[model samples]
Target: MTATALTMLNCHLTIPALYFRGINDMYVRHSRIQHGVGQGSFHSATVEFSATGRHRFDYVFDCGALKYAKLSPEFQYALKRVSLTKRAPGGNKAVLDLMVLSHFDADHMNGAQSLVKRYAVDRIVLPYLGVEELALIIASQADAIDKDTLKELHGLANGVGKLWKRPVTMVKTGPRKTEERVFSDDPQREPPDAERSEPPRTQEFPHPVSVVLESTGAAPGTVMLDEDNLVVGSSSAGRHDTWKLRFWNRGLHATLGEPGIWQDFERHYKRELPQTQTVVVPHHGAAPNAGARFYNPGLNHRPRVNAVISYAVRNSHGHPHPSVLADIAYAGGRLLRVTDDTRLGYQEIYLFRP
Candidate 1:
């Protein structure tokens, strides 16, 4: 009878130095707009991640997309995530669940109006536009904030659009055209190669999760959203079902296109698949949709998989790239970089560690 427990809430990521906060308003308006309205037409940007409290998470990056010219502070780092509604142990968060704001810049919606002053949100997934082009990019960032932070970023985007008023599955995770699988020893063709030939099955699209909450519930009301699409840290009842919990987050490469984002992540990894051994990587390690590969050709011959990078470490973009960590270490996977020890940070919990 041995059971150990330790739960901490604080998964943050922030990077607010984008070209030194807009490089002195662009060289002091470059000579008052040198000849008129100029200074390279303003491009000052920043913002990476945030949740701040009630589980914690924050990040915002900027430094001229970095080619290098002064970036110390250990190149900025932070991580911590563990809390997805009630109890403990992975799996479940799909009451239509999703929170993907993949691209819209600003390091991906940094402090995104603190998600309506901070969580309780239902749905807000996005890949592109629909609602008047996302309200003209939130009215050009409320004309560069300042009317009381643009009235508190429009009253926190209208209380996070009424808890992200469910129904924003504007899916988009394209870039399908990746066909390169061959591992056969051919005993004379058709079906005699049992030691090889296992990488030819693809086609499943529609991933646009920014926020979802429709769980009516066998278990996902406290917010553990299930049906398999994991988001853990704390959730129980004795934990261990829904096949060891699962979660994905790499949708929208450019928007409902690009071969339809690899046919919507090959149909959610071919219907709730990912033999749980722990997983987490989808854009935080950056690399466009491939966002740090996690290839698992059914673990053909098994015994390998070490991916858990959530980004933060000299992140002037060059994110976890080493060719996306050498293509997830050439498919056997093994990257692990939640900033690789920020003294303690990286919480997206739910590990009853069965």
Candidate 2:
């Protein structure tokens, strides 16, 4: 696509799509995916069942180690679009509808502060922050971070607090059900009055596609579905043909001291799990994150699903675990790797149809 066409698409239009971007972290890189139909690369994820452009859901997920140098131009394009369209009468509204942190690892969250500093984020989603995690952050960063900057690190430090004044929703797993809490302000009872600043603009470039696009090849040892153009399914009548993207942290059991937390959480979504068109192979396709029961005959109902594995090319952990890949293929799912060799830029799947 030409730069002009890409810019036009980013600013004026919103499409139902998904985008998975590779991360450049040193040891264990991460990736980010957004689902939406907008002209710029930074548009929040959204789902639309029809082409009428009337119905949709605005949301976004995981921010990898994307730098401001790369994201600033897209932000500017979005701002320009908003200015022209009058979508934001006063100024640019929240650029990020939701920021989901799969885990607290630096590779996954290193760009979070930069994201918040650059965009108007509406909400943040993450796994529940427990006392132990907070203690660890404090103990580890106590010397590196000074008292003056400690308060600013509340969200990163505690896993629940304001980032640029945006509310945070922390998900907690339970035996029977999952729970969530919203943190609009400081959880420590201190006033969250950090000054906000605008992200600096740089040379303009087309924002990376925020949504998924069709691909030609499939990863080895997996089956690629041919229904690339199929939108919403017939079963979705009244709903907006939603695409659910879930995140699982490998450290959940360690943090919660409950081995079954992830299992229980999966059980809660079992009914709708099969309907998911794309699954971000949890924990970069770690073995611990994928159990046999998850892909058991009855549980693996989706005839064709995209299993996304976001890992670094030179990963030290040897991610995209063999067992995990086997289970996904056995369950009749395709593998979409976000690494250099795979070059599977972003695997787009149609979530609904008219």
Candidate 3:
């Protein structure tokens, strides 16, 4: 169906988003952190995908770490203040349809375990890159972490799999690209290749759950946008059409051999990409993630897109990079920052109507 048709369904959809403020610390420096105070770009969003009101999807993207602490009281309080729970049918705690970890950076995944413990997460999504490969990439970057924190982050990543009994899906892009595969029970063991995968372990949820992966193709170096399935139906059980909602994560830096995020995304999913109205600003609005080329209206244009950048107040690195902000404005998109100055703490960006 056309986006115009979807606009007719806008009254039937409500998108509520919560962006958390990261604890600021002066010590660590990495490309992910534009300024001295690193940003915790934690986002929890809920999408009511079906008109039946039976197909609601909740997702958490990159649970950011609290400053100087693993489970900081401030962070916990924020979670509670937001009423983030797994309770069914009315408890404020959201029953997550999916939990996505963009990369292995501590800032990206530090609070993952806390989320698992607090919410009913049905699936976890990881990049196609292996843990070791991701770890090495972080090591090569500037402002590399010490051995202890690295170990701790790795441990926490592993813990998410162990703590959640549901499926863990890993996604990658390229010619060797594979369909989303659900991992076996053992979190430590290597999962079988996607082509040779087995059935996922059974999950008993209060509602039906579906995960959708939008990829360019099986070509080498493609981009895959992963998220919960988006369905269009006048009623929840009526004939449904599926759509995509892309969440861009700054996973790897561009190298001589690697394609840039937007480049790969454009090459593979350009037709579908433009249809996306909402996007999470990559790398907490870092410059590299929002290069001019990505937002150039003439080249890669998205008409009337809403871009959300999660930044901390008074962060060391001035985020929502000035240039990126200009580019976003140039593309005719509204820019929303998660910090208090902007829209923070349980705000509704889109509401469904009949």
TM-score of each: 0.22, 0.52, 0.58
RMSD of each: 23.3, 16.1, 12.5
> lDDT value for candidate 1?
0.28
Selected candidate, larger lDDT, 1 vs 3 = 3
lDDT of 1 by residue, 135-162 (tens): 6556665443335443433433343322
lDDT of 2 at 129: 56
Off by over 4 Å in 1: 1-123, 126-214, 217-281, 284-316, 333-354
Give the alpha carbon lDDT tens digit for every residue of 224-269 in model 3: 4332222211122221222233332333543211245435444433
Question: After superposition on all CA atoms, how large is the RMSD of candidate 1?
Answer: 23.3
Could you arrange the candidates by lDDT from highest to lowest? 3, 2, 1
- In model 1, how large is the Cα lDDT of residue 115? 35
